[model samples]
Target: MKVDIMKKRRTVLNGKPFSIVDDLTKMDLTERKKWAPQVKQLYDSGTRLRFSGGKWRDSAGKSYIFVFNLTLDKKGGVQKTNFNALDACLSYLDKFSLDDVWRTRNPLSSGFTWTSNIDNIRCRLDFFLISKKLVNKVNDCYFQPPLQSDHHIVILHCDISIEPRGPGYWKFNNSLLLDPAYIDLVNSLISNYSSDPHNSNQNPASFWEGLKFTIRNNTIRFSKLKANDSHIYEKNLIKKIAQLESDSISDENLLRELKDARSNLHLLYKNKLEGIMIRSKARWVEEGEQNSKYFLSLEKRNK
Candidate 1:
């Protein structure tokens, strides 16, 4: 048996403060009348119809509100035919002292969180509404690339205080050896150090240690620069791919570019995953239990 759940005409809340309610239009005449008194009671009590069930409060006696993935237009404005519905939503927000995190941060921003090529529609329908008390805690809010969906992912970064820790050891990336320019630069550094009379004055052991330190510093700097470049490149590629996918329906040329971009991204991920697997296997080999049949079997299974 298949259960068909209808998701339309409903609001989904994330925190403890809000309750779900079915759309008023979905109720039959009798059901509407049956719920009329309860709805009126909620209104009279200054509770939003959609968020009528509960209230959330923290240990510090601070109230919080959360509104997630609301249905709205491109400008992040809520639209409804019923003036009462709109008034209830606005009044509830006003009463609770809530604010839109996105709008508060990026008042001039315009973008779409969702798109439908078939209907030729694009809009920013997803948003986060939080209590004004938590507004200062919001570090950042932005859109991210979606996976297997027409809607973009909304990311919220909040600052939370925690115990600080010292920096851990850094491991050199072996992938840098794959670059010919890196290899040449390292070689030149070694040659220059050996030729320098200042470095030649040192003993053999000291010279070797100094050379190793020089190479390590250069390697760390090179890797950091390369990683930053790769990060920027990947972000650009993802944005380009998303735009191409959105526009390719009308242009054949864009489709080819999209395929190429996807292939490049796939290759990038493949390389990164391969590096992670290699590092993980290396760590396992160093720390894994010895001469155990179960461990051997697990290793074979992973292979």
Candidate 2:
């Protein structure tokens, strides 16, 4: 029979929920009577984040996510034989390496779990730990009996967060899309400026270079220019401008990576790009009011 939570009676002591309130309150690890039965509850938290081994809470209240897959046909009997949860957890880590992104503390890092489900088949879980004792339930799944199908039918019910990572970022103005006439005007300006070097102490190509180079230096400049001919949209716009500037950063991939530095607009911020995004004068501090906003999304920083 599956473990049923609905039918159980919970004992709450001193405003905390525990596996066994009486057992947890009086924990004596050396004593067999106290230690043997509730051994799982007696964890010695180490250094900094004591519960760092598993998932932890996110800035938001939502739990971080962990995911992995497993192939368990080699493990013999299904019903009679008992499977180890620790082995399952290890197997999950092997399949999906969550540790790689966890250190960055991006939205992706979290821990995974595997437990037998109420259904006839074994199940896998992608959970985020909220605390040493609390965790967020994200992906709940179960497998079907290995009937005619080559593999078990696994049904996944997931609650994943897709945020600023989703598409549609702010766009630049279309006037920067250079054309033949604009190029001709730039060449015309170059001819005029270069021809009168004796009369004018200004740089020879200053006029043409100013139009071509300034567009990249300032996004606000792109908003003001008037397009005359070629109207480049995405990559084409970047390519055309780069060709004119000689040293232009028109690559979409590179552009996305430098979003935080280029603009305060980022999918998320990193420490290096933090204060650099700020662009100018503050109207002095206000008293008795909080200046920063904190959004709480729950997440686990492990697995």
Candidate 3:
């Protein structure tokens, strides 16, 4: 699912001219009753609402609609005043078949949000109301900790099909010969093939075919072994460095090991990038220019 932030002026919500009265908590019962029709109108027009418990005023002289219990404690409870206001707001939404996404999925549980050390009043300070049509499209809902907010992030996984990717094309890395270990492995494979007695009586075509098959098998086996070792080596080096730093200690030997591992990992990445460029048939990406912005942009376009 794609995620993004939608920022808009409070004067116009869901493309409608609505007053921006943001402080729903300070609103008297009469004011809430006054705005009920406007809220219903917006909800009917495919406007999803997120209650933030934070207030603001907009150009249209309307209060921002942030009506939720912000100061909840621990055990799923709320102040009488806050509970009344929440009930009124939810009553309006429930009339139009708009429901909390999480509560609808699990009716026996209360939603979660920002908490405080106040009177142990557990409540959901953050919430979203979705119409029946959009609710049907939703597949799952969960929360993630926000990077820079006190509130947890809410995520919606909808039943939207992603664009299908094309069939992949594979290419062997001829640069493998540059590595001493790879050269030695290839030579050893050839030596073993020549010494095998099973192919001593084979014709010229059969001998070449058998040799090619043996080389391909050996290449695949070595490639798998190297791939596994490369990943494990990189992971172990990173873990070692992290452990040393966490203990407030420094070791020159560990540092050297980490540096060498990083160099090798960089080489692997370079090989993969070159392979990608070759597969794209991008001749414009000259040597030493593969990391340039133009090369990256063109490579993405080609893919």
Candidate 4:
């Protein structure tokens, strides 16, 4: 039965526009209409509908049609990320100043720029962000699947389209990936200090003192960053790391060239051997400051 359902649901949702049904109860009308408008239809389309309530508009000034759920299950993702990931995802949205904001693509529905499916045991906290900054765009959605009685949360991509209505649908922008700007903050803190190791490290006491500030400062920004596709983040990190490592060599000058080389090698070793270092250090080694200091002290002893 599970296999049959999976096969059918996959067939239903594939290449079709999907609506996000955060609340299953929304399907029951008459009851919900008594209180507020519920989701009439939703979908994952190749074209985003710039909506003003129930109506939509396009660049040509034609009415944009809001497409909706063609099947019971919607399109999205699933993964196991801890609260830290959740926090990061929020910071990502906040980078765009998009948290706690009420926005409407359609007249019937409006919600905060970000919403968290929070629970105590929570098993998992589902994360989502809706962006008006790029209206008619598929906002961020990160979902994780469940197994052996687990429930998978569906995530979305920023480039997703609303349902295509009438005429030929615009081709989906496969290359359109909006950088979750919150990631910029994390990378800024980490990479901007590439040459100066002292900047990124917290004062321990001061760091924790500012932990709330760092963690909750711009939650919307970080969360969106966290929710972004990991492949892109990983690729960019590799590029940035390479660029910084190159710059690092020049910054140290010839006097420290030999020393910098050794330090660089150590950092590489420490990162590649992070698993081993964490075991020996009884903590995760701070790749930049801690490793750099370790090498500098060793160089001094040798001299």
TM-score against truth, every candidate: 0.54, 0.19, 0.39, 0.17
Could you arrange the candidates by TM-score from highest to lowest?
A: 1, 3, 2, 4
lDDT per residue as tens, model 2, 111-197: 222222222233223222122222122244333222222233333332433335554344443333454654565566556645765
Looking at candidate 1, what is the lDDT of residue 43? 39
**Residue range 75-194, candidate 4, lDDT tens digits:** 122323234433543453454333322223333331111112222112222223343444445444333322112233333545543477674322222122254555565556544434
Sorted by lDDT (best first), the order is 1, 3, 4, 2
Residues 88-182 of candidate 3: C-alpha lDDT, one tens digit per residue: 56665666565567667755544444433243333344555555555776788754332234464566665654557885643466767787998
lDDT head-to-head 1 vs 4, winner: 1
lDDT of each: 0.58, 0.31, 0.53, 0.34
For all predictions, the C-alpha RMSD in Å is 12.8, 20.5, 12.9, 24.8
Q: Which ranges of candidate 3 are over 4 A from the true structure?
A: 1-170, 240-268, 286-303
Model 1, global lDDT: 0.58
Superposed by TM-score, candidate 2 places the C-alpha of residue 239 at a distance from the truth, in angstroms, of: 31
Candidate 1 — which residues are off by over 4 angstroms?
Answer: 1-100, 103-110, 116-126, 147-151, 161-167, 239-249, 276-303
The candidate that wins on TM-score is 1
Greater TM-score among 1 and 4 belongs to 1
Worst 10 residues of 2 by lDDT: 294-303
